[model samples]
Target: MIASMWSLLAERRDFFAQLALEHLAISGVAIAVALVLGGLFGGLMAEHQRMAKPSLALVNFLYTIPSISLLGFLIPFSGVGNVTAVITLTMYALLPMVRATYTGLSNIDPTLIEAARGMGSTDGQTMRRVKLPLALPYVMSGIRSMATMTIALAGIASFIGAGGLGVAIYRGITTNNAAMTMDGSLLTALLALLVDMVLGFVERRVGMRGTEGRATNRRMAATFAAVVVVGALVGVVRALAPATSPAIRVATKPMTEQYVMGYMLKDLIEHDSGLTVELTEGVGGGTSNIEPAMESGEFDIYPEYTGTAWNAVLKKEGAYSEGLFDQLRQEYADRLGFEWLGMYGFNDTYGLVVRREVAERYGISSYSDLAHVAGQLRLGAEYDFFEREDGYRALCDDYGMSFGKTMDLDIGLKYQALAEGQIDAMVVFTTDGQLSTSDAVVLVDDRRFFSSYLCGNVVRSQVLEEHPELRQILSKLDDTITDEDMSAMNHAVEGEGREPEDVAREFLERKGLLQ
Candidate 1:
């Protein structure tokens, strides 16, 4: 595993380099912001006892919120990507920073301050010459803790479209690629350790600087200021960088098929409209996460399922009908400020899957056929599929299936489990890339238990208005990707181990869409 990870890193060295830099920048800015704010707040609260309890309580409360939830909450205000990542990570860093500072400052001897005052020192002089030096170790300790957390949470921020090491980690997990997961995990650990080491050096320097003369202290302070100024400048430039014209952002869920679609859109849009396309793949929460992001202008377009938008985004209940498409488009436009483009000539609905050999041996050609032998077989499914209304419970109840054993497996690992014979059957998507290569058979949904999940582009209406030609550009793909085409494309990536970009381009080129 280690060798494979190292090999993958060597192969994708440039990509990993960019990801590492982004991770560092996001974490660095967040820690810097937290230290400044937390230091001031901690100092004031140390002197003012009454405000300390409530203020510390608030910071502690913010710390308790999960990183993913916090990022989601910040999306509406900060949008997706670096801004939201920095803000959320800063919030996460506050508790440790504030607490450490207050503790350090309060622990200093009152007699030292009295002695400084007796020497005719003013409040500023006393703090700079006596109190601050005494509290330096404690404050530095807090900064150390905050720095570690900022780096770690910055990784999690990748779920919200923030570019960092977390993106690689999540992608590896979703793709069931052990090498990719190891690469991300290893890099993230090294980064955290590196940050800790740097902070430790600074902490030691601050502690030792007390013995130096005024000249030395002045020089050290000046150097620190210069570093801060440069960091701030770099941050401003990144935050304010203008996106190129005729540009649109594309996003996708954390799955092979979604990734394929995202790349396909990037290729087609860039080729047809001569526009710049920035694609952010594997957005967590799928459509639910990406919908708010699109509404907030983080992403201009993404492929979404009509059933998912209805149930997950719009929170509608009950089964869908044939007219669902038109209603969904109208409601999305009128209420959600988005528009639905053409379907991609396929329905990637949920269904049962079993090995072709197993299906033939058991005479289980359909979901209803599974009922006879369910009690003798083990099944695997993803957690989300287990929890969704259209998922496990309804399917079992519809088909009257009661498997002898069931396992809630990671979405990425489920296919491997099924292929290895660890599972007798598993929940499968009709359009999964693995379906073609794994020799798995999708059990017919004879009872029509699952809803139609028509796939298409969901774009911000404002984006369409701004680039009016976008509608035509997107429509070029309408009803072009049939089930067979999707299956082949998926196999090209999952089975043939091809990059989604190459597979998407090859398909588009074959279709003459690149012309």
Candidate 2:
């Protein structure tokens, strides 16, 4: 595993290097801010007996909020990017910093302070020359804790457009590639350890500065100053990087198919229209984030399913029926100001699947067929599949399925579970790339409980008004991809270890859509 990780690191050094830089930039800014503000507030609170308890309580309360929720709350203000990630992570670091500073300072011996006063030192002087120096170790401890956490959280920042190792991790999960996940995780872990070690060295050197000569202390301070300056420069550069010109921001939900579709859209739009397309794939919040982002012009376009927009967006009940597209188009335009574009000519809906051998043995060709044998089988499904309106409950109620046991598994791992016979059946997407590679057979939806999930580009209505030519260029994908085409493209990327952009470019070139 270590050898494989090293190989992966060597192969993707350039990509990983930039990701590491981004991670450093993010964590650096957050730690710097937390160190100053948190240390100051903590020190002040330690002296202010009346304010200490309430302020610490507030800091503790802030710390209790989940990282994801804090990130979501900041999205409206920071607008989804490195800035948001920095702000969220900075907030997370505050409590530890404050507590460490307070604890360290409060534990200082009062006799030393009295001696300083007896030597005619003022309160401020005593704090600076004696108390602060004594508290340096504790403050360093806080900084160390914040530094480690900042690095770890920076990986998750990729979900909100804060590019870091988390991007690699998400890409790996979406593609079901273990090597890629390990590549990102291992690097992030190593990076955290490096930061901790560096901080520890700084802490020890600073603590020993007084015992050493003035020259050594000056040299140590200079080294620390240089490090801080470099970190600040990286953060500034990342924050001020120029946006691509004439670019339409495109987003995608968290899945392999969405990523493939995102790449396809980027390729075709760039080829036909010569527009710079900024694609942000695998948006963590899915439609919940994408829908609001489109409405707010955070992004210009994304691929969305008709049924998902129908049920999740429209908040309507009942199974899908005909005229779903028309309703979605009209309602989106009227209510959400989004214009639905051409369909990809595929229905990527959910289906209950079992190993081909199991299906054949039980003569299960449809949902009705499975119902008779469901009691004898154990089922597995993605966690979200059990929560969707047309998910486990609706499926079971409609098909009268009563499995012996049911389990909610990670979507990425469900294929492996079913393949290993840990599950007799699983819920799968109709157009999943894995379907072609796996020996699983999707049962027919005899009761039609699930809705049609016809997919296509959804853009803000105003974006179309401005870039009228975009409609024509994007329409090139209309009725272009069949279920087989999508499945094959997915397989190429997810199974064959090919890049999504490569697969998309190949398809477009083969179709004469790219020059």
Candidate 3:
């Protein structure tokens, strides 16, 4: 285990660095924006007696909404990515800074303001020389809180394709790799600590220097000058840049959407034909990642589940099967100009997984047994499973079973909880490629509640015409992957600490998909 973890960490060192940088960038930008906006609002509230209660109440209300929920609500308008993540983080960070500013400014000595006025100072001069200087420490305190909040919120931003240490953690959880999870958590904590210390030192230094009264005005002028210069350079670059690229670009769902699909295909497509295939992996899970990219022409190829494409992509709602797959394929080809490239030889069906020991003790051999014992078992599942139209809620309603305990966990953590015996059962993907190695048993779905989730590639009709050979290569891989093969391949990347690209290449070569 130690050797495997070391190898995995060594392989992902660059990714970790990139994740750290992304986290810092997102957090820094959000905190900076919060500082300016929150600071200004706080100052205004401090001066105006009537605005204080309403403004404070508003910031406090925003602070109460869960970060992830807020991100989800923003998805329709903003779509997923760094933009949504940053905006949410910025809003979340505002409360602490605004509250601190309000408290700091409001608490400043009225005597100091009176003294400044008595010295023949104007109202603006009294604010600059007395109240503002007295409130510096309070402002710094708010900034510190804002910085911390930003760091915490940035971690959650990974779900929306905002790259950060959270992505690493989420990946680890989904794959049930404890080492990866620990690495991500440790790194995030370290980043937060480092930022706090640096900012703490700066805050102290600035507080000690005292407010220069004129420093804010000077800083504002410098900032305006910098923005003007930067804008001019950006305009010049845009004018000089070429408008077209010769390489064929392929867009795919983010990493979380279809897990390993795009990652698996990255090398296969690139090396097979020497084509410059651009892979755009969505960070958001299936629906959010696949639809927008496909509709926007941002992606040319993405793997979509038969069930998802049927119900989600095609807007056809009913029970699913291999037949639904063909129908959806034909529908998409005719209406959406998208081609279904056939199945990848395996169906990653959803099933109820129970600890082997628990199954043995109860003699629970099938879905019927689970229904009978449902009240005795604890269930663990991902958030979407509870809310999606055809998710766990529907399944449970059909079964007429209520779990004794239900734990909301990320897909990755569900496996861990089940393995640790913390949960009696969990929703699991059938072809996860790790079940064979784990001590869990998937119950037979006698009721056939789950739809077929055959793995396959889908591409834009135009891209297929341009790169017909690519389609043929990918088609040859259809239905060739068995459950064991997928599990093993997944293990190589998520378990053994190998790169997805390298694993995909080896699989293709071994299968003769690559010449």
Candidate 4:
């Protein structure tokens, strides 16, 4: 496994290197802020005994908030991307710094402080010359821990649409690529270790400076200063880098089909319109994040589904049908200033799938058939399925079904769980790559419980007016993709390890939509 990891690293050094720099920039900023804020707060607490308990309690409370929970909580206020990520990391890094400094200052010998005072030292002078110097070791220890934890936590920033090694990890899991997952995990661990080593070396050097000499101390300080300056410069450059770009920005949800379709649009836009397109893949929370970004003009276009627009965007209930398409389109334009274009000609709706043996034994082939045996079977689905308004409960109520047990499974692990008999049935999407080859029976939605989710390109109306010619180019995808084509493309990326762009490019050329 280690050798395979090294081989993967060698194959993708440039990819990992870019993400590593982003991780460092994010973690660095958070650590720097924590150090400053924590130092000030620690100093204040040390000076005031009354302030100590409350300050510690507050940070401790923040520290106890789960990382994912904190991120979800911050999204409405801060929106998405780097700002939310940095705030999350800084909050987590604070507790260590505050406690360390407070402990160090409080533990200082009163006799030593008195001797300095007896020598005609002012209270300020005693703190600066005597107490602070003695507490350096504790502060260093805190910084070391704070820096390490920050680096490790920074990987999660990618999960929320910020760039980092977590992109590789999350994408790998979504694509079912083990090597990619390992590559990301390996990179994060290496980055954390590297930061820990650098801090450890500096802490040791500072500790030994008094015994070593003024000249050695000066050299050590210079080395540390140079490192900090370089890191700060890199971060500043990244934050201030000119985006002077006129490229049309596109975004995608974190799914294999979306990745392929996003690349197809990007490729076709560049090919036919003679315009640049910058595609941002895997935009975290799907419509919840991307829709707001679109409204805010952070993105110009993204692929969306009809039922999602009807239910999630418009807040209308029941299944989408041909009669509702016009209303769906008009409401989007009226309410959100958005336009739907380039219908992909596929129904990527939900399905209830069961192990073939279970279906055969129970004679279950539709929701009605399953309803009779549901109480004897265990059902599994992703977390969202249970929480969605038009999801689990609605379906169960419609079909008058109740499973023996319902398991909340990760989107990726449902199939494995079904195959292992941990679950007798699971929820699936019609175009999921795994469905093409899995030995499972897809039960018909006899009662039409779930809504139709026809896919399309959703564009901001303002962008259409600005680049009127872009409309014609994007329409090339209208009614082009069928369920079979999409399922094959998804399978290529998820099941066969083929790149999404390569699969998309091939399909477009085959359809004569690309040169």
TM-score-better candidate, 1 vs 2: 2
Q: Could you give candidate 3's per-residue lDDT for residues 213-282 as a string of tens digits?
A: 3476468558968996896688689878864543554544433324556655766676667577655444
Candidate 1 is scored at a TM of 0.87
Best by TM-score: 4
Please, what are the lDDT tens digits per residue for candidate 4 over residues 1-515? 67766776797799889888888878888999999999989988998989999889999999999998899898877867888899999999999999999989989998999999999999999988999989999999999999988988887887677888887887777766678788998788889999889988877766664555657879878897999899779868976896554579898887889989989988998888757898777877688788888898878999999988887778887877767999999999999999998888998988999999999999999989999999999999977678676889889989899999999876666777888899999999899998978889998888778888999989999999988987888888888999988898889987887778889999999999987
Candidates 2 and 3 compared: the better one by lDDT is 2
TM-scores of the models, in the given order?
0.87, 0.90, 0.86, 0.93
The global C-alpha lDDT for each of the candidates, from Candidate 1 onward, is: 0.83, 0.85, 0.75, 0.87
Q: Residue 126 of model 3: what lDDT?
A: 79
* Model 2 misplacement above 4 A: 1-7, 50-54, 72-79, 210-244, 355-365, 372-378, 402-406
| Candidate 2 accuracy as TM-score | 0.90
How does residue 86 of candidate 3 score in lDDT?
85
**Each prediction's RMSD to truth:** 3.4, 2.9, 4.1, 2.3
How many angstroms is residue 134 displaced in model 4 relative to the true structure, after the best TM-score fit? 2.2
